[model samples]
Structures are given as structure tokens and as C-alpha cells.
Target: MSIVRYLTHPQVQIDPDVPVPQWGLSPIGRARTEALAQASWLARTTQVISSGERKAIETAEIIAIRLGIMIEIREAMHENDRSATGFLKPAEFEQVADQFFAEPHLSVRGWERAIDAQARIVREAEAVLARNRPGDILFVGHGGVGTLLFCHTAGCPIDRVHDQPAGGGNLFAFARDGRQVVHGWRRMEEVAA
Candidate 1:
């Protein structure tokens, strides 16, 4: 079965001063990504794609090196546009996320509406799927947008998006042709360290 696996780049070096897009994974993040490459499931992957973001690109690069495959950059796999609100301190950001999830479509305090991000994610991922042919297709992207996109693609209720953690550890696996989810969602945390 053809599988589309949505992977989120692991722990990033959080910098509130820079745009999130420009920030890359921390050393620990790189370690996590490398660990992912060594996972048994990854042995079957034949193709790879990544968001052009630094962290996502870094993750994809690790996978490409291990799998000996070229990494295709897809704009659709990019993180949600958080440019309107450049950066927030951790506690402050958590509060914002709490509000954002409550009314996902409406803008609250300058964050991009989750609905808009979700729509773009769905569109971009669909386009990516059109290019795949059997084996396994790996997509490396940021967390928020990846979760939103995966929910859209899987026909899951947006409210149940939390059924899968909203972190880099989450992976969404789906059958390419039938769009049937072979696996609903799995956490990297479940993989042995």
C-alpha cells in the first residue's frame, strides 16, 4: 500500500526574536530526527518531501541522506503563517494557543486563523499526494500546520484533531489511492528511544 506519512520536525531552538520559519531544530532536535530515520518503518520509504523551513528542511535532509533519496520541497508543507504575531514568550504563547483553538476560524490577538492554515495544508498535501506512486512517501513539515493538514486529509473532526498530539512526534499515515487511513495517527514517543 502507498503511504503518505506526515512528519513534524522535532524540538527547535525556540527564538522569539526571529520568525519561526527561519529557526531550525536544536541539536536535540537533530538527534530526534536521526532517530526517526533509524526507525524500522522508515526502511521502506522511497520518496521524501519537506517544507522549505529550516527545521523541516533539516529533518528532510537527515532522512534523504539515510534513504539515499532526493528531498522535494513543497510550499504546501510549510508551517502556518505566524507572521502577524511575530513571537511570544512561552507562557504567553500558550495562552494565545488556548484561545486560538477555541475559535479556530476567527482571528484572536493577531494569530492566523487555524481555518486558513488548515485549508492551505489540505490543498498542499493533496497536491503532494498526486505526485506519489506506491512504496512510502515521507513529508517533513512543522507541527501546527502538519496536524491541521492531517486532520483535513483524514476526514477527522477538527475538534478531534487532538486525538493526535500537536507536536513534532506525531505522524499521520494514509493510503495514497483510496485515501483510506491505514493507520490513523502514531506518536514518535511510542517508538523506543
Candidate 2:
């Protein structure tokens, strides 16, 4: 089967003083990247692509290093732009995050319109799929936007995806045969150690 795996880097860091995109994964997050690299699936991944973000780059690098391959960075693959809001202390962002998910069609507290971000993610993702013929492909990205892309590709409404499951920090698999076919999805926690 032509499989594409979408993986969000494990708990990267957020720089409260800086923008989210610029931040790299924390030490623990780095370990998680390494762990992900050890998965049997890594051997089957012919190519790895990632968001230009440091965390995604780091995560992709881990797999690349193990496989003796290189990571391709794509700006379109980046997490939805969160430049408008600086770092949100956990307590603060949490309260408003629900509202964003609750109203997928609206912007989350003016951060980025959920609908617009999802559209861009879908566009870029389709572009990636176009490049590869039918092998295992890995894309390292973020949680929220990743979910949206997966939802859209699966023909599921973006807003309702949240109700189905929490998809961030996970590996989501899809098959393409002139159409999107969801293979499987698993949160990091659910992955067998």
C-alpha cells in the first residue's frame, strides 16, 4: 500500500519570550524523537519531510540520522502560523483552546482562522502527496493544524474531528489511490513501548 505517515514532533518547547515557530523541542521531546526513530516503521519510510520549524526539523533529523537519510524542509508544511499570539502560559491558552476547537470555522481568539489554516494545510499536504508515488512518507509537523489536515483528507468535517479524538503528538497514516484513505492513527501514549 502507498502509505503516508503524518507525525507531530513530541512535546517541543515554546519560548514564552519568542514566537512558537522558532522554538525547538525540549530535552525530553528530543528523547521522544529518538524513540520514534527506533520504530519499525522508520525502516520503511523512503523519505522524510518536515515543517521548517526547529522541533519538526529536530524530530525529522532523528529519523534521518538513524536511516542515513536527509530531511526535506518545506515551509508550506509548517504549523499554522501562530505569530499573532506570543507564548501563552499553559493555564491561559487552555481556556481558550476549547473555543477554537468548538468553533472550527472561526479563528481561535484571532490567532489564525481555523478554516483558513486547514485549507492551507490541505493544499500543501496534497502537494507533498503529488511528489511521492507509493512508498512510506513521513511528515513531521504540529498538533492542531495536523489534525485539521488529517480530518480534511479523511473527508471528515474539521470541527468534528476534535470530538472524535485528540490527534496531536501522534502518527496518523493515510493511503492515497486518487483519493484519501485513512489507515490508522495513534497517539504517542498509545504507541507500544
Candidate 3:
């Protein structure tokens, strides 16, 4: 069975002035991705699919370059649209995120509704899986939509409790054939361990 892994980008250079999707990976994020490129588990990943967001593209590029593969960018795979609020402080974002998850059907402050985000992510994943290619597949994206995909694959409710850790750079794997979750979230570095 092929393994399909979804990895969230690590820390990003968060700039309120820049559009969230345009934010690039911070130094820490680059270093983490560089290290992740060395993971033996990634050896089988023949396809690298990434969210169109800059941070995610940067993260995917590092691994794809090392694996000698080109990345396929999916714009619709972006994080839940928080463009309505533009940017929010950490505390504010967290609070809003909580509400976003708690009320899946209701949009929070113009942000995309949790239910809608889940549907989008699930659609994206299923579309790629339908290709039915050989070897493992790697999906590089943001934590928000990554969590949405994870929850769906795990057969769990859409909730923030299944979210990645605070600093991001986490991953979850599922079997491509069955869409069966092999594991929940784990640090990127721990993928091969």
C-alpha cells in the first residue's frame, strides 16, 4: 500500500503587512525542511504536492529538490480563508480559531466556515488520490487545512483538538489504497522514527 503524508509548513515569517498566503518560511522553517529532506521515509515519495501559499511552496521545494521531483501546486489547497480579517495577533487568532472549530457550519468573522474548509481539503485529497499512481505521495500545506484533511481521513469530527502542535511542522500519514489513517500528528523529524 502507498503511504500518503500531509506535512504542514514550519514557522513562517509572519508579517502583518504581507498577505497571509504570501508569507514565506522563516529561517527556522527552512532549516526544519532541510532536515526533513533527509528523512529516509521520504525516499519513496515520488510526488510532491503543495499548497500554493508561499510558505508551503518553500517547504515543498526543499524536499522535492532533494528527492529529484518537481512539485505540483494546488491553489485550492490553501489554508481556510482568513482574508476577511487580513491578519490577527496570536492571541486573537487562537481565539478565533477556537470558535472556527467549535462552530463548524458558521463562518467566524468572515473567515471560511470550518465545514467548508473541510470539504475543500477533502476534495483536493480525493482528487489527487484518484490518480492512483505508484510510490508514496507527499502533501505540503498549512496547519489549518491540514487539520481539516487529517480529521476527515481519521473519521473524526472537525475539531481543533486534532490540530498540529503550536510551531507547526507536523505530519500525518494514511494508506492511499484504503484512505486509512496510519497515524495522527507527529513532528516532521519523527516521521522516519
User: All candidates' TM-scores?
Assistant: 0.88, 0.87, 0.98
Q: Which lDDT values do the candidates have, in the order given?
A: 0.76, 0.74, 0.93
Most accurate candidate by lDDT: 3
Candidate 2 residue lDDT tens string, 99-159: 6666767777576777877888788778878886556788888787787877777787766
Give the alpha carbon lDDT tens digit for every residue of 35-54 in model 3.
Answer: 98999989999999999999
lDDT order of candidates, best first?
Answer: 3, 1, 2
lDDT of 1 by residue, 1-193 (tens): 7777888887898887778898988988888788778777787788888898988899899988998889999866677676777788878877777666667778868777888878888887788777666678888886677767666766765553354565465677777888777665667656431
Off by over 4 Å in 3: none
lDDT for 55 in candidate 2 is: 82
Count clashing residue pairs in model 1.
0
Best by TM-score: 3
Q: Which whole-number lDDT from 0 to 100 does residue 72 have in model 1?
A: 91
